[model samples]
Target: MTGSLISPRVDYASDPARSRGRFQIEPESRTRTPFQRDRDRIIHASAFRRLKMKTQVFVAHEGDHFRTRLTHSLEVAQIARSVARTLGLDEDLAEALALAHDLGHPPFGHAGEDQLDECMEAFGGFDHNAQTLRVVTRLEQRYPTFDGLNLTFETLEGLIKHNGPVLKNGKRMQDLPQAFLDFEHLEQLDLDTYAGPEAQVAALSDDIAYNNHDIDDGLSAGLFTIEDIKDVPLVGRIFHQVQKDYPLLDRQRVISEAVRRLIGVWIEDLTAETSRRAKRLNPKSVEDVRNLNEPLVAFSEKLDAEQKELRRFLMERMYRHYKVNRKRSQAKRILKELFGLFLSEPDTLPPPWNETAQQMTKDARARVVCDYIAGMTDNYAIDEHRRLFNLDAMI
Candidate 1:
């Protein structure tokens, strides 16, 4: 109800008052903006609750301290709010996008997604972004009048196109995911253009959160040492600075300070670069932002290169560490086996899902199976696999 105290809303920011409105019109909220209402709905969604047990980079049961999807989303939302406030964008919209961005990710992180996609290859393949749209649009069945939360059009558009346009230069992309196509039939998402400025902020905020948090997780896991990353461009320099600043600081504190500083550097660069772009482009409205050839929110050229270097370091030293690969291998096996068994025996699925799969054709049944599997948490998937595959285990 209170207006943003940080700064006035910018001309290019998405305005909830002037929102394009939800697909299924509902009475307006007296206490919250449409964007804020969308954020609240996402927070209360069952899919969002399941994120608590979903993997980020580590399995849920791997360690109590490791970040899960829920914590990661929270972090992303925090960063998004901060960045949006600084940039005078709609903080609620940015925060909502951040919270909902990863709802489509399956259990066991990218490993689970990869295995599911492989299993679904004959059934149009799986894509997380498309699945995210499906989750918000068709999968979630909370509303009595609609399947999804009936989020604002702006929120839906941002959710799908946050990374950028789905279509290339007003042209349909080859091998486009079925979920996106399905949604497009119901609502035109302007798939050929970048999303609004708030969505752009949320997208970059996601990048900032994961990049920094993974460093912390990797360090905690001992996949690599601070010394190992001491040469990784901006990351390395920040760590070195932290060490120099506090010679007696413990390892954890040093990592905490370094990661904090690194995130700050990224936020500053993103804010400055975005402001520079806005000044140059002088977008008069959020529509102008969407129609721009390039994204309004971005890291400086120098920082973008450095961030890529950091990603490369993480890819080699952390994500692909032998220990992580072992987990990935096991996760892939569990998901792949689960997909195979469920597709082969729809009766294996629980209750309504089984009934739904039984009514559909093979391709449609495969998608049903995929959805059931994709909705699982890491532990749930593992347990489900055990229940199905282990003859001695009770069903």
Candidate 2:
């Protein structure tokens, strides 16, 4: 883990000791803060390690250099901690949020998620954010008395609503995801208000990490050339500046330098914007941050606009590139096929999954299939598909 970049604490930072304590209360760790322990628990979770083989933009076997979910989470955590430190928020809380944010994503990035959602359409639909909450709160089964990791309530709050409140006016704006509704009966997260400042920072930090890293990945994949993005927003300007500053620089070095600088630009803008909001709000505590109508952490309006334009360019150029589209189609088919086979003939599922399926209602069994598939890594899903469908494939 990267060392904290800044160390000035402020009144609004989430205090670890004073945190809303764990779901199943246990003795506190003598050596760690609550938030620090939250971070450690997340890092040590089984799902956290599963991230290694899960796709970010490219499949795990595609190349040695591409980012996997594990690497991406680490990058997001690094960026979040840096921003949190600069803003005098709880670095540990922000880092934990960043790391835990993507735990719900299935094997093949958005393609896998899209397919899973389609398969579960009649079964309350699949939502990664909700699945992440489920993974931590209901599925992990790490403790003797609890089903999940038994995380602190503060961590749970951020995990559930880091994007923003699930509620609007007095009720949820849309049907709440099943996992969230399940947990709601156990503990109520104020779904109408924003998360604390640390979660807010972690959310924006994700934007920074993916946007910049995608540029690098796209370049490496030959999905688009550096020149192709040279006319995009801030990204274009950075690329041109790098080329001018290092005329003889190698291709890889140029992309790396530009991506690094872009991350710095984003972090600078975010810190400035958040500081401006902090001054205006003068929030006295973490609760004050949540109760406020607007988020305390955010990018500046100008940067937000630039990022939108850049996203448009990437959508057309990299995300929709023919090669990636082909894989998306294949990934969707693989996940869809797996879901069908498992849901229709639950006995085919190995051991405990098959045993558990026997007792569930149709919809409940479908969800069990959904969870099983959603937890698979890219290669595991592919191999499972082959085993189920390919007569010549090894068992």
Candidate 3:
């Protein structure tokens, strides 16, 4: 079976021009590919800069190391790069996709998202994943003639793969590609199928990163306890899974240490399983291809199921806690006041806003209203609320 299962190495999509650039930092006496260029471009974009102003689970200013979207993206990039390298896949593509994945998230974290969706319900409810793709491809206008980033097909496909790929013309990344809807296009299947190992690794790595960090953030917010987490049936299963495998179940360091061990366990299982299959079939020839012997990416299904249950636990016990509800209610009142006062009495709005609002179309005004409210940081939101309502004096 050495060569029997192998197909010829045919890349219909890896062309340099496919990524829309002629090399901004041309080879320092070398050649850089388009995907590599894409990665670098993202490393410097302003939208990426705004990530510092955005929230992950907690407010961005809470602590230096507490995760921001920027921090989360960096972590995801590191994890994705590690997995992609180990799997013999293109690391640049994985890195670029991971870095750009959350670029569309609005301010004030997901609360801002909930508000945006509620406000835009008539405009086809908001989805961060789709919005992410839009940011790089269209909405993120960094320059004239640059309403979109015009990223490579691979990067775009991965961004939209959160739910599934869209198709247009005959390509997976074309504007809602028609080929994607045909169901016969194997390569166009939603990420659940046919994604190369990098794509799969990137997906699971995101889950791993967010799950662990959300728990960390929840604790920081004084929202949950190790004891509380340990009591859940599924959470208990995870804790036990870690203790049975890891030697240093140090009580003071348990959760963070456990997260690392769990990551290693999944990586080991995935690597061993794929390597066994490759050797069993004597896949020498295919393994010679750039990324062939690289293990197919996967997480333990058991672990993934455990994570889902754990997240539900957080949602019920921490995220929906009354204190959190109070904060969100305060947030809503602030947003509603800002929206109503700014729009209803544009005369009283900040100077630039009045002009901006006057020029905004009805749909555009609604979107601007969402953006205006979403852009307010926690303290800014509160202060603006007081100032607008005359509950407090302005600066």
Best by lDDT: 1
* Clashing residue pairs found in predicted model 3: 87-294, 167-176, 167-177, 168-177, 168-178
Cα lDDT tens digits for candidate 3, 274-340: 4454455343322132143233445446655666787799889777888767666666566666766
User: Which has the higher lDDT value, candidate number 1 or candidate number 2?
Assistant: 1
Estimate, for each residue in 1-395, the C-alpha lDDT of model 2 and write its tens digit. Answer: 98855758999889887898876779999998888888898999999999999997777878878899999999999999998888888889999999999999999999999999999999989989999998998878777887878888878889888679878656653577776776753346777888888899889999999999999899999999987887888999999999999999999999999999999999999999989988998999999999998899988999999999989988998888898998899999999999999999999998889999978999999999998999999989999999999999957
lDDT of 1: 0.90
Let me know the TM-score candidate 2 reaches against the reference structure: 0.97
Number of clashing pairs per prediction, in order: 0, 0, 5
**All models: lDDT?**
0.90, 0.89, 0.60
TM-score of each: 0.97, 0.97, 0.72
For model 1, how does the per-residue alpha-carbon lDDT over 139-257 read when each residue is reduced to its tens digit?
99998888988899888988888679888754565558876777844347787889999999999999999999999999999999999998899898999989999999999999999
Q: Candidate 3 versus the native: TM-score?
A: 0.72
- Candidate 3: list runs displaced more than 4 Å: 1-31, 61-65, 166-197, 231-252, 269-297, 342-356, 371-387, 390-395
RMSD of 3: 7.5
